[model samples]
Target: MHFDLVDLRLFIQIAESPSMTQGARKAFMSPAAASARIKNLEESLASRLLYRDSRGVELTPAGQLFLQHARVIMRQVDYMKNEFTEYGAEASGHIRIFANTTAATEFLPEILAGFLAQRPGVTVDLQERLSRDIVRGVMDGSTDIGIIAGPIKADGLQVIHFSTDQLIVITPLEHPLAQRKKIKLTETLSYPHIGLHEGTTLLRFLNEQVALSGQTLNMRIQVYSFEAMCRMVEAGVGLAIIPESSARRHQQTMGLKIIELDEPWRVRERSILVRDLEALPAVIRALISIFLTHDSARERRS
Candidate 1:
């Protein structure tokens, strides 16, 4: 009987966090109290909610179903709040968006700012996540829109063409590979490389491709941001493979060379994904229109 929005919020936190105790801390509840509340919630709903394992917890089938409804309820609650606030001030609503590092690093910021500038009423909450996680967020109704690198599986969502980003190799001006117009990845296997962190999509792709080809990529240093990797490359530490957009910016002033990667995977075809394009809020739909139109124009010009 004590279950309410607080319980739902805690439940979502628990689902996302590594452990229930961590979720409890995030929700500002004692672990024992959080456990008791979840038990009460399960009993009230007449179903088991979570499967506990040594590593962490996972949702049961019923928990997964409940999570979808919970996210919708929470999003609607936020919308209602934003609605009243906007009604009082005649402002646009907030939209939640997720994207991969490629989009977040090289694409979304300036375009989102321009779009928001044109429509002062709308506010946005953008987050960087892996493509698969972004897809999951859209499918679960937790995110309004997602931009991701494609040729991906998106089972119950609408996908729209965004942009195709070419990948390039970045190297210091003195590096041997810098002089090459286009070079195969295998040609660089002998040199030390600057790599992105382990879980990043591009890094994983590079690792998988190298492993598949029976080549070992010697990662001398790993960095979290493309900018940092570029800086390291400029310092003559090692070379990196990054999106052309990222490499071009660094090339302008960093004295770095951008070599076009001569591989089929050099092109990262990206797309915008949504759970229900027609059901999007008016402001969000308008924002999407602006973004996609601009991107398409750029693509055409290129």
Candidate 2:
């Protein structure tokens, strides 16, 4: 009825390896000891967890179920250890943030630099995720905060206005589309496009929109960064959809024309979402405060 972490860890290792000997070696235990520990674990559970043969070992159905729970337990243990390890230091805690494409790429770098500079003890784990996924991560306690763009329904979470990010198309100055002031996404799909590389949050979102429009994007080239994509577009390669901030900055130097997107969804209001604002640690609250202060300053100027 009672099982220890060591027994569970060893069982997981054994299940992953081709043989108990290899698993024992990885676990830093002798094969005999490993075998005995596993035997005791199976006896306690009253189930045959593995099948042994001359070649290797295979997990039984019960073992498969046990392995899933064991992995989850170990992961939570590690996460807990990491979360509290710095609490003994001065004003420190780990914060996990999930942000969408625009927030992660265009907004957070400068803000995070200042935040981290002031508090050396605090650490942030920031990850880029789709907005819907970021919302789920915040609600499920996987992420402490979420920054998302567009109007995604967050029924119960606390929401704060972060910034406004608008998507616009950029084309070479002499291109046919450059003559126009505005256009729809569907209209641009017929033309060759320069896009961000696969797996970017922005590209994924755009692809989803393309699918919903019942059309496919004709991507001529895919690059890693907005700067690169702009360069490609300026070379008459293809048109590109980029953030308005980036398009404005690049337009000053690059020979590109900014064309407004006529669709209503093109202008996205980015927001910060959190499960609870009052319950957050001081460090996270400070970070959120910085976000709001900067956003407010920008709004006032605009």
Candidate 3:
């Protein structure tokens, strides 16, 4: 049977709220108008779609079955609009992305600059959050894409290897370890170490490495943001083992000395995550291509 989009929309709204009055408010129609529309829909389908009671309204079996099909139809309708809306240079859209502090502060600026240069009409909304939050945002559809450090196990998300980064031990310029090219992981335990919170990906990696070696890291301070960690290290509060990208960014400002870790736990892979690659918008796909290609070139150089 043929149904207008408006009828389907009203049906979904009624199914969602159940109360005709509440559904009318949501659909921005008067109660009488909304009721008339719903009655017309039921008449057209020749089915009892809702059962009214003293408390509110409930969907009949026919309504429940119709709601499922209505949802799919609405989704397809939305997809069609989005597909055509972002079609060309004149067609504009917004992309929302989530990233951890290191990637947000270090990596995304250049990429965004290039993207905006190419697509001036498009807008990007970036949220800087912890790795776990970034992953959650991607899974929940709150963000279009996420850039994070490894060891996340999220089902249905496509994880692409974008870049590999090393962790560096940083101290104030005049600190004892400054003179050393590389310091043993064991040596760090002797000194106060400023670290990210236990929940962060970096801290999780560090803890795993320490546990694997049958040792534990001695954390002097636990902070949420990398900028805070760098500031603390520069103030001589303690040395910190932070992502190399973060250390590179703050090296000049903090006058921090960065030394490589001696053994196995130094390197890490950074990844880009998307809920579904095939479902991503063209703008996001373009950004992903740029990120992967740029990182590949950098890898070839190294």
The regions of model 2 sitting more than 4 angstroms off are: 1-91
Instruction: Tell me the tens digit of each residue's lDDT in model 2 across 167-242.
Output: 9999999888889988999989989999987877789878989999989999999987788988999999999998
Error of 3 at 221 (Å): 5.2
What's the TM-score of every candidate structure?
A: 0.79, 0.72, 0.65
Compare candidates 1 and 3 on TM-score and give the better one. Answer: 1
User: What's the true lDDT of residue 144 in model 2?
Assistant: 82
Candidate 1 residue pairs in backbone clash: 92-121
Q: Determine which window of 10 residues in candidate 1 has minimal summed lDDT.
A: 82-91
**Candidate 2 whole-model C-alpha lDDT, 0 to 1:** 0.84
lDDT string for model 3 (1-302, tens) is 55688888887787778588888888888989988887888888899889877777899999877776676566445545555763572235677888876687677898788878877667888887777888877775557789987567878789998888888899988888889998888888878889877656677767877887688888889997778998998899999988887788787677789999887757777899887787665666878899989887866875
Error of model 1, residue 43, in angstroms? 6.0
- Of 1 and 2, which scores higher on TM-score? 1
Q: Give the distance in Å from residue 143's predicted Cα in candidate 3 to where it truly belongs.
A: 2.9
